[model samples]
Target: MEFIIDTVNLEDIKEAVEYMPIVGVTSNPSIVKKTSPKDFFKHMKEVREIIGKERSLHIQVISKECDEIVKEAHRILEEIDDQVYIKVPVSYEGVKAIKKLKAEGVHVTATAVYDLMQAYMALAAGADYIAPYVNRIGNLGNDPMELINELSNRIVQDGYDCKILAASFKGVQQVRDAFNYGSQAITAPVEVLKQIFANPSIEKAVNDFNSDWYDVYGEGKGICDL
Candidate 1:
């Protein structure tokens, strides 16, 4: 499973990659607005430099019209490098853009997917990834896990190449459920990911082990020191 960070904060991205097996970085206009970088392309290039070429970088298009979305995707590729996965919303126009981009062999991620039909359309359009808003869907009284499960089954049955990149998570459980439901990837904020190790029991266990080791090894002595 691929763990992607869904933010544009460089410091967080650097820290996350340093400690975890981060596979990619994904950004939407709302995420970009949080960082408010002075130069968008330059900032994205810096992000690419940090993650390196092996990892994928997904950048979203802002336009709503089909032709404008396609043009925006081209502009992003030209500005940020063609390897960047252009994220287009799963709307009528956006699906059209996804088809056009995929026809040209460009990497496309269909975003803002809320229903099974949206995901089906994206998969049919040959989108590389389909992002379902897990938390948002749950807030709307819908079962996000059910949605992911159905999509997962459909992908396997139809032999589609698209992978589910679950997004919009508010808690660690949501992340775990996404994976449990057969999502191939998940993109979440660094804070949410870090919480996986935030439990007090984990730290208490580590401290107890260290205390016992120090008591037996004579104060500050450790295995390497011995």
Candidate 2:
């Protein structure tokens, strides 16, 4: 599975890129709200530069009408590279806009999905990606993993090219679960990525190896061997 840095912090994104092997960056209204930058587009441009043109930059549109969504999508398209995937909600109007944009060859990501049916609908509407809020589903007393698995099976059965992007990850377990269910990608926060390296056994293993190596040779001698 692929990981995406779901944040607006440039420093965290850079660190994540260096260590996590992320495929993209995902941003939404809440993420932007936290940053509260004066120029959202300018920040997006900086993010694009950091991630580079080869990686996907998933961005959301704040429009309700298909025309407005299209307009926003075009604006973002011009501002960023071709890897920009414009995200829209899973509402009635959003579905319409997704269809129109998809027909026009614009890459569209249908976000805010919570159920198997919504995932199916997004694929049928020609969305390039479907973002299901897995944690949100669990909060609402549903099993997000089962929903993701069902959608994965459906996508396989229909031979659709759409990939499941598991969003709204609450912790590392949700990320693991999403991947275990065959999600192509996951959007998680920086803290969660850091937690990937926080296992006690991993820490102990690294420490023990370093101690043995230090006992064998001094720091200078180890450096010389390298």
Candidate 3:
């Protein structure tokens, strides 16, 4: 499964890439607003440099009209590298844009997906990735895992190349559930991702092992030192 970071913070991205197997970085307008970079394209280029060309970089388009969305997608490709995935909301117009972009052989990610129908539309429109808002769907009193399961089944049955990129996670459990439910990729904040190792028992186990090693080798001694 691919672990993607859903933020625009360069420092967090750098740190996460250093420690975690982060496959991609995603950014929406809200995420971009948090950093408020002076030059958006330049900042994105910096992000690309950090992640390198192998990992994907997703940048959302702000346009609402189909034509403008297509134009913006091309602009993003021109401004950023062509390998960047253009994220379009799964709206009527956005689906149209996805079709157009896909026809042009551009990488597209359909975002803001809340329902199964939205995902179906994006998949039919040939989107490379479909991002469903997990926490937001749960907050709306809908079962996000069920939706993910259904979508996953559909992808396998229909033999579609599109991947389910689960987003909008509130906790580590939600992230795990997303993967358990068959999400191919999950994009969450670094803080939430770090929660995977937050259990005290894990630290205690490590401490206990270190203590045993010290008992045998003397204080502050390790196998590598010897």
List, residue by residue over 79-160, the lDDT tens digit for candidate 2.
7766689999988899999999899898888999987887788899999989999989999999999988999898899999
Residue 198 miss distance in model 3 (angstroms) = 1.5
TM-score versus the correct structure, for each prediction: 0.99, 0.95, 0.99
Considering every candidate listed, which one attains the maximal lDDT? 1
Candidate number that wins on TM-score, 2 or 3: 3
Candidate 1 lDDT over 11-82, as tens digits, reads 999999999999999999999999999999999999999999999999999999999999999999999898
| Global lDDT of model 3 | 0.96
User: What is the lDDT of every predicted structure here?
Assistant: 0.96, 0.88, 0.96
**Which 10 consecutive positions of candidate 1 have the poorest summed lDDT?**
214-223
Minimum summed lDDT over a 10-residue window in model 2 is located at 217-226
For model 1, what is the error of residue 201's alpha carbon versus the real structure, in angstroms, after optimal superposition? 0.6
For 196-222, candidate 3 gives per-residue lDDT tens digits of: 889999999999999999999999988
RMSD of each: 0.6, 1.5, 0.6
